[model samples]
Target: NSVSEYTKLQKEISSKRQSLYTLVESGSGNLTKTAIDKINAIRAEMSALEIKKDKAYKRLKIAKDAYADKIRSIKREELGQFDGRFVPELAIPAGTRYLANIILECKSYFGGPIEMNVWRGVAAYNCGLGRTKEWNGLPYIRETVLYTRDILYNLTRMLELKYAYSTGDSDLIAKTKRKMGV
Candidate 1:
């Protein structure tokens, strides 16, 4: 059943992909969105395992960042703008560092509470500083909106876990861990 279902979804995605260019060219606003969403839904269903794995990876990243206190916010004097060069193919750490720097810069530019700044900075990171500022927070684009929402949710969860740890609340710790799927 699943194999057939997967094949069925694949065919659906293929057909949607075929129409996507036509939809774009014709400027069929809502129809284009409908087709894109349908294709994405099928892809998402197929990528469920990948989503789980990605969450696990995010948890590991959080743990690594916390355990080492490895990446303090880059100093204000040192936050440099991206030079539009060096897109490191295999250097994840380097790429993360670059993204983190952009976030720090965006936070400083936004000039609010640290937490809010981080949130805004992340939105800017996904979209762009100019776009995020123009929208006066998160842009209306679906991908950026979801990306920012997920990051904020993860950050909140991380804070809750830290509180649980600090307060010696085993029950909260266990509950949070369960929520975190780890």
Candidate 2:
């Protein structure tokens, strides 16, 4: 993991610093040319390691964006209403794809799929919708709610479209009024 890699690099830097300190603390009236060269070499190594860490971080970000784009493209192509209705295909938004990835990660963390309701509820919880207690009665980290609202909003719109098409009603206003007993 990136965190572990970061920790390892940090430890290496600290060890190098300690070694340099020990060399300096020794009872030597003046530093020799060889000692100076060794110190310079350690500093260069640390600088190179820092650069490598930065590059790794950038690569991770790029990979995540690419993965999300791939997910979005796949969902856009494959997702549709299958209620024996001629529902037109719709495009999956980028935000939805990103949230879906997060939901998938969460699902993987908790083992495979259990049930549809469970999956939806967990996905909702992951996206920061309903309270964790109300969803699956599991404690979720507050920080994990970052993308929930956007994902849920986009998903709701998609569902509405699917429902509208399935029922042969293209008018959402009329559907809403009928459902509300207006």
Candidate 3:
């Protein structure tokens, strides 16, 4: 459930940091009114995200506590204490289901070959539907481009692994698992 939330927060932080850096760099000597305004806006966005991150951290702590409590309640031996490196997110599922729904939505809104629509949806998830529509496909943003590429590449590998499993070839399964780092 929190997978997308974490990813979104991380992307926003990177975007904001990059924007701030570019604005400051471009303003080298004289900071124009426009540049100052944009910098302020970026700072405001960063502040908002900081608050969001704080809330998310609190939620993470709550999740950790709940997980520990559940573990303690088990009838088996006491697990003792959890390490600082321990995270409850390991038990959480990925946002694949939500992203799948978004892909379907994109297909409905932007009708095209399912393959093209899937790319559009993936890009939309990285950026936004509005941005994707404006670009008529994936936006030129570097982060979005890489995000889409990585996701699609992983998905392709997943499909290949699935097919390998269906084939029931132990050799193929072993090779696929090794390739996928499974």
Give the best candidate by TM-score.
3
If both were scored by TM-score, which would come out higher, candidate 2 or candidate 3? 3
Residue 33, candidate 1: Cα error in Å is 22
Considering lDDT, which of the candidate structures 1 and 3 is the better prediction for this target?
A: 3
Local distance difference test values of all predictions, in order: 0.64, 0.55, 0.76
- Checking candidate 1 for backbone clashes, the offending pairs are none
Summing lDDT over every window of 10 consecutive residues in candidate 2, give the lowest-scoring window: 81-90
lDDT for 179 in candidate 1 is 84
State the weakest 10-residue window (summed lDDT) of model 3.
Answer: 83-92
Between which residue pairs do clashes occur in model 3? none
TM-score of each: 0.45, 0.31, 0.47
Once all C-alphas are superposed, what RMSD does model 2 give against the true structure? 16.0
- At residue 32, what lDDT does model 2 achieve? 89
* Full-model lDDT, candidate 1: 0.64
Worst 10 residues of 1 by lDDT: 81-90
Count of residue pairs whose backbone atoms collide, per candidate: 0, 1, 0
